[model samples]
Structures are given as C-alpha cells and as structure tokens.
Target chain A: MKTIKNGIFNENPTFVLMLGLCPTLAVTNTFEGAYVMGLCVLTVLLITNFIVSIIKKLIPENVKIPVYILLITTAVTALDLLLKQYVPALHETLGIYLPLIAVNCIVLGRALSVASVSSVGKSLLDAIGIGLGFTLSLSLLGLFREVLGANTITVMDGISSFTGYHAVFQVFPENSIIPMTIFQKPAGAFLTLGLFLAFFNYIKEKRGAAK
Target chain B: MSLFQLFITSMLTENIVLTKFLGICPFIGTSKKESGAIGMGISVTVVIVLSSIITYLLYNYVLVPTNTTYLKTLLFVLVIASTVQLLERIIKHHFKQLDHLLGIFLPLIATNCAVLGTTLLNVNNGYSFIEMIVFSLGSGLGFALVIYIFSTIRERMEFANIPKCFKGAPIALITASIMALVFSRFF
Candidate 1:
C-alpha cells in the first residue's frame, strides 16, 4: 500500500519535480514508447538502488559522484544490451534515449537521495515508488503529446510498415485547427513541459486558495 | 549537407533556445534584467563553447581512444561539472557584481539539459570540431536572444493584469509556447 502511494503520487517524477525531460519528451510519442522507457528506467532504478544501498557504507564521500555514475552507466548499458537483444524494435525507437538513462537523474536521484538512507527492503519499495511514479509521468506526458501532436495512440510494433491509429480526442478538421508546430520539435518539448509545469502550479495554487 | 550549412543551420534553423529548446531553464529563470541576461548569456556562451571543445577533446583523445565510449556520458558530465565548479570560483574572485547575478545560475548550468543536449548533439551529429564551436556559439546566442525577449515580456507581465492561475509559470509557459510558435517563422 505504501509502495503504491509512493510511485503514483508522493514522489511523482515528471509532474512534481520535472526530472529527466530529454527522454520524456523525445521518446514519449506513443503509449508503447512510454511503457518501454518506463520499464527500462524501472529496471535501472531498482537494480541501481539495491546495489547502491548494499555498497553505501563502502563508498567514500569524495568519490560518491563517480561511483554513482559508474553504477548508472553499467546498469543502463546492460539494460541497453538486453533490450536490444529482446525487444529490438523498442531498442531502435528509443535510440539515444535508452543509453541516456545514465543521465536521467531520477535513477541516481532516487538512489542517492533515498536508497542511501533506507534499509534494502525500504530501498526496494522506494525504487518501486519512484520508478512507477516516473513511468506514470512519462506516459501521461506522452498521452498529451501523442493525442495533440499526431492524434494517435499506438501500442506495439516490430515492423517498419506497421501504422499507429488513434481517434482525435479534440476534433477539429485539419483545416480549421491551427496545429502547433513547436510541439513537434525541441521547442515544443520545452513548451509542453512548461505548460504542464504551469498546470501543476495552477492546481497547487487553486487548492491552496480554496483552503 | 556541407560544412557551412551545418554552421548556418545550427545558428539559425535550429538555434538552441529559439529552435532546439535546449537551455530554456536559464533562458527563463536567469533572465530577469536585460543586462543580467546578457552577462548570463555570455557566461553560458563561453562555458558552452569551451565545454564543447573540452568534451570533444576528451571524447576523441581519451574516451574513444581508450574504447571508453561507454563512459562518454559520465566523462562528459564530470568534465562539465568540474569545469563549471572551477569557473564559478574564477568568476567570484574576478568579477563582483557579475558574480552575484550569475552566481546562482552558474552551478545550475551543470544540470541544464542544454549543456548536456549540446554535448549529446555534437557527438550524435558527428560534428567536426569547428562545427561544434559554431553550434555552441549559435546555441548560446539563440539562448541569449530568446532570454532577452522572454525577460522583456516577463517584466511587462509583472504589471499586466494576469489571471490568478496564470500568474507565474503558467502564463510564462503559455507565452513561451506562443513565442516558440513565433520563432518557428525562421525555419
């Protein structure tokens, strides 16, 4: 129960703190993409946390950063290889982002910030909490992006010719609707993240005002 | 496809802030005053260009040569982090007012996606050393240009009758979306 609460809400990665936006925006064009990323990050987070926890006492303070980097790199590389071997399609679509999990911060942030303090059991729970939180956030953001950008939702694919089809949530004939071009590019990545940040703040403010 | 096109394209077509969306955190967060924005821009510009060269050297000279491309991400991050730390000290001792304004943001540059984004972009794009510097400078200038504009809007926004919900980041983001849309005209 506590584990569930941790991932879904309290330590929510995307909405709460805005960690790891590079891959969040880049890979999250579809639900399946988000799921793959989420799973990958989840695996990295869980493994890194447990290992970091076990080795916490041995690591010297000065070299902590390097230690963390090596740990994340190893895990991400291993994950990269495994994913490529098993889920070659997701591996291709994810591309740079999959390797970029090394810098995602959520993995290291959770590992350093939480795993160091808690017991191994607690760290495992925290990993799930944060891992799931990050996953959920990535997908939700992807949901917004996929719906608005392409008006599509796709699940899984192993072939190049396969198509993704999703009904338009907000129907406006293509001619009438002014499709935002920035949303499709890096600028759009910033624009969307900023808007979502604003949305989170607005909700926080509104709830605060009511109280 | 040619070298000059890469230079021109990075500078104008995919200008980092206005186009590539790298470095928007500092673009929006540090750009409260025009003068300060300029200082921050120059500081960031210098750091980015240097970091690019350094990371490139390290990648080519050390990591790649050693078959440590696996460590490229970590090594790149370490180089930038330590470099920024050193630069922060130099700035604090050398410039007084500049330090106070840009000081808060100097360290933040370490984590800025733009910093990592450029490093990642350079390697990913397989840019030559000259091309990397050009891209870095263009990215910096684009960042400076947009921050200057965004700051002007924010200063004006302070006086405008903004809605309660849209008061801070909300309105700012909405404005940026439009501004991004506006910048898209160049492409």
Candidate 2:
C-alpha cells in the first residue's frame, strides 16, 4: 500500500520523477492516444518488472544493463506485434511511439531500480503502483490537451468500429470559441506540462510549510 | 532526397528534440551548462553516427538475410550500449583531455533515445548508407545546436526573475515551449 501510494503520489513518474517525458508529451495530443499509450506502458511495466525480478540474481553484474535492455526490447516487441494484430487502428495512431516504448526510461528505470533489487512480489507491487501512476498522469495530461485544444473529449472513437459503442463527449458546440490551437501542437504539450509541474510544486511547498 | 536537403531537414526542420521529442531527457539534464551541453552534443553525434552505420550494416547483412529483423530493437540497443562503452575506452586511451570532459555523460549516452531512434528511423526510411550517414550526422549536429542555444538561454535565465513555483525544470520547459513555437516556423 505504501509502495503504491509512493508511486502514484509521492514519486509520480510524470510530475515528480519526470522519467518518461517523450511519450508523455508526444502522445497526449488526443485522449485515446494518451489512454492507450498509458495502458501499454502499464502492461509493459508490469511484465518487465516481474521478469526482471525473477531473473535478477542470474543476470551477471557486469552485463545487467544490456540484459535488462534485451528483456525490455523483447517485451515491447511482443506488445507491439500483439497491438498491431488485434488493434490495428490504435496501432496505426501510435506509430513509432509504440515501438519507442522499448526505450522509455520509465520501464528501464524500474527494471534497474526496484525490480533488480527487490523480491518478486515487492517488484510486482511496485510495477502496479508505478503503472497506475503513469496512467493517471498521462490520462490527465491527455484530457487537458484534448479538451482545451480540440474542445472535445475522445474516449473510444477508433475502437468503436469493432466494438459498436462510440464514446466521444463534445464539451461545446463547434466553432463557438476560437480554439487555442497551440494546445494541440508541440508547444502546447510543453506549456501544459510546465504548468502542471509548477502547480504540483506549489502544492508540495504548501504542504511542507503547513507540516 | 538530396544530401543537402536531407541534412537541413533533419537538423532544423525535423529536429530530434524540439519536433520529434526523441531525446528530451539529456536535452534538459545536460543543458544547464553550456560546456557540458557541447560535450554531450559532440558525444551524441559521434555515437549516433557510429551506431547508425553499424546498425545499418547489421540490419542489411545479418538481420535481413537471416529473417530475424524482428530483433532490430534488441540488436540495435546492444550495438549502441557496446558502442558507447568502446567509445569511452578509446577516448580515455587516445584523448585524455576529451575523456575527462565527457566522463559521466559517456555512459549516459547509452540511454539517449536519439542514438537508437536515428538508427531505427534510418532503416524505416530505407535510406542508403551515405544518406543514413548524412541524416544521422545532421540530426546529431542539430541536437547539439539546439542544446547549445538552450544552455545559453538558461544561463541568461539565471539572472531573470522567475516565480518560486516555476523555478527550475518548469521554467526550462516553458522556455522550451517558446523555443518549440519558434522552431515550428521552419515548417
């Protein structure tokens, strides 16, 4: 429980640790994209953490980093293939960012920091905690970007073709206000992230002062 | 695409950091000091170019013929990790001064996505060997250029008044947002 809380709040990957900024900024342009990316990372994190923990002792100290990289790359490749075969549309939307998961520092960082040093059960817990934290952060960032930038919330448009249940909520009428188009651009990603970081820091300082 | 055109396109138009966001970790991490940023940039360039060439050859010769192209990501990462290690040793042995300059950052280059990203992009785009070289070199130079400029800006930012909440990383990111807006003009 403490481990989970630590990951989700104390050491939030996006706000606090700031480990995987690339995917956080790049894919948050749309809610669906961000959601899927977050889930994918969560899944990969869980699997890699479990595997790395189990085999941590066997991996030679000198070659552990490459070994971890190989493990992560393999897991990401498997996930990529599965996504391509099952979720072709979402897969297309993800594009290279999906494969880039193999290099995402969050996954490797956990593999090195927690998984490699801890017991298998503890590592699994850490993975779940961090995964959920990452998902929350990515989804939050995505929600803000999509809502403000496009004036709509995208939940499940691409998946609707196969599932037959559309899920998009329009916040306002189209053309009502001049959309701040920058929120959808690369610049918007940085700005949104910066503001969020600042807000988190302010809250932390306030809590510290009160304590 | 022509060599010069590809060079310019990768360097400024499709910047690895500002546009693609491949290597932001080191971009912000090492950009606090201009001297450190230059060292990182040059090291990244050398690593990217060397890794790209090696990965390209391995892909065309070993992976393609053996029908194991699926292992590109794993193999490319291994190549990069080893390349960084080898480069470190060679620099330490040959250029003692340069080795001292890039001591800690040498190993960190292994994780910088730009190295692997460039190699993967080169293969995905199906560039020839020479074109791959130019693209990788251009991307490295571009990364270095942007980091150098950003470091200078950050140095000046030290004197400027910033809010307490937006002191360190947040301000840098906001600055990057503006820089990204400016870079978008190249498009």
The number of the candidate with the highest TM-score is 2
Q: Over 4 Å off in model 1, which ranges?
A: A84-92, A158-211, B1-4, B24-28, B32-36, B92-101, B185-187
Predicted complex 1: DockQ: 0.35
TM-score, prediction 1: 0.81
Q: Per-residue lDDT tens digits of candidate 2, residues A113-185?
A: 9999999999999998999999999999999999999998999976676677789888877785636789998
Q: What is the C-alpha DockQ of each candidate?
A: 0.35, 0.75
What fraction of the real A-B contacts shows up in model 2? 0.67
RMSD of each: 4.1, 1.6
Q: For candidate 1, lDDT tens digit of each residue in A95-211?
A: 767766776768878887888878898888888888788888878777776666665555556422243443224434565344444455555665677777777778888888899
- What are the runs in model 2 whose C-alpha is more than 4 Å off? A161-164, A176-178
Per-residue CA lDDT of model 1 for B31-91, tens digit only, reads 6677777777777776788788899888888887788776666677777778889889998
Q: Residue B129 lDDT in model 1?
A: 82
Return the lDDT, model 2, position A114: 98
TM-scores, all candidates, are 0.81, 0.96
